[model samples]
Target: MTIRLAILASGRGSNLQAILDAIAAGTLDARVVGVFSDRPDAQALQRVPEALRWSRTPKSFANRAAFDAALADAVAASAPDWVVCVGYMRILGAAFVQRFHGRVLNIHPSLLPKYKGLHTHQRALEAGDAWHGASVHFVVPELDAGAVIAQARIAVEPTDDADALAARVLTVEHPLLLHVLGLATAGRLAESAGHALVDGQRLYTPLPLPLNPT
Candidate 1:
């Protein structure tokens, strides 16, 4: 069965494009049912049919809860088995997370449990970390605190700056996300008891990225 996905994005949507490209190339057994964004002008909304695109500025709503409620309803309308958030900048509310609960996933630009919010590349560089990468994890209301599903690792070279590190991480994030989604589409992954489950077993740590070319 093809997994239906609802994408929530707030930026250029490069990862969103990756998913669409993978589907078109028959590398992924999934279909994007909708693409929603908090920024009305977000470029990601253009990747899908106009009817499948939903967007509105957060300021248009009375408050964050109202906005999240509305956003959740829009996403729910798509009936996706998974809600995938890529570069979605807004912090989701508890109510919205509870609505979807175990079915929402997000790809963060940091190794997670590390940089939970923005400026991840700079944080890793400042800390002199030898490694940094992206993580695909369940999205709880606590902002990247959910159990990680898997991650792609890239060495932080001695000469690397924030931009260079970020660019490199972006390359790996695509493949990492696709790999994790493959597990989801195959019915081998899920959020179980606040932990990540793969093939009905607990994921003790984020799985290393597969050896496929990125």
Candidate 2:
């Protein structure tokens, strides 16, 4: 069965591009039915056909809840089997998370439980952490505090700044999201009893990021 995928992004759709590339390369058996964003000028919108692209300004809504409600409606219209958030800046409300539950996934720039929110690279540098990476996880209501499925680790260089670190992490993020999504499309990855499951087995720890050459 072909997996119907929907994407929500707020900036340049690097991850979105990765998924598209994977689908085109016949590495992922899925179709991106819809691409939605809060910003009309988000570069991610250009990755898909105009008909599949959707944009709405959050300021037009009275509150975050209202915006998310409308966004949920837009996503539901596509009847996506899974919703992936890549560079999506907004935090989803409880109602939206509950509506999709385990089906919604997100990729974060830092190893989760370390930096849950933005400025991940700067935070890691400030903390003087030795390693930094990205995480692919199930999206829950509490920020990035969801069950992680996989992570890609990269060593922090002494000369690395936020942008430099981000660029390195992004290299792994592309392959990581593609790898996890492939598992999801094949029904090999799922959430069970608040824990992530792979091939019907519980995942106590996130799987390591697959090695991809720069």
Candidate 3:
């Protein structure tokens, strides 16, 4: 069965493009029901039809909680089996998370357990890490501390700068999210007690993607 997706993005929507491309190429069995953004001018909204697009500035609402309540209602209206946050900039509140608890997913540009928030590439370079990459995981309340489903790794070269490292990671990240979502739509992936399960078994470690060309 094809799964319906509700995407939340706040930027260029490069990852959203990957999903769209995959579905168009007949590689993914999913349909994008809607695209939601917190920023009125977000480029991501342009990728979907006008009817499937929704945006509301936080300033229009009294507070963050109020904004989230409206956002949750909009997302629930689509009845999405999965909610994928691509470049969504807002931090989701507890009310929104609990509403669709086990169904939210996010892809972060780091090895995770290292850099949970922004500037991951620079942080890794400064720390002299040998490897750096992106991780696709379940989105829980505690930032990116949820169970990782899979990751795409890239070696950090001695000559690499933050920009260079980030560019390299982006190449693999697209495929990484697609891979994880493929399993999800196929009924081979799930979340239980904040843990990731694949093929009905616990995923002790995130499945790693082999290195691709940078």
Number of the top-ranking candidate, with TM-score as the measure: 3
lDDT of 1 by residue, 148-208 (tens): 9999888888889999899999999999999999999899998888999999999999899
- The pairs that clash in candidate 2 are none
Whole-model lDDT values for every prediction: 0.93, 0.93, 0.93
Can you give the lDDT of residue 93 in candidate 2? 91
Error of 2 at 110 (Å): 0.4
Q: Could you tell me every candidate's TM-score relative to the true structure?
A: 0.97, 0.97, 0.97
CA deviation > 4 Å runs, candidate 2:
210-214
lDDT of 3 by residue, 1-214 (tens): 9999999999999999999999999999999999999998999999988999999999999999999999999999999999999988888998999999989999999987779988999999989999999999998878888899999998898889999998899999999999999998999998998899999899998998998645
Q: What would the per-residue lDDT of candidate 2 be over residues 1-214, giving only the tens digit for each residue?
A: 7899999999999999999999999989999999999999999999999999999999999999999999999999999999999999999899998898889999999999899998999999999998999999999889998899999989898999999999999999998999899899889988866789999999989999664433
Q: Judge candidate 3 against the unseen true structure and give its global Cα lDDT, from 0 to 1.
A: 0.93
Per-candidate RMSD, Å: 1.5, 1.3, 1.0
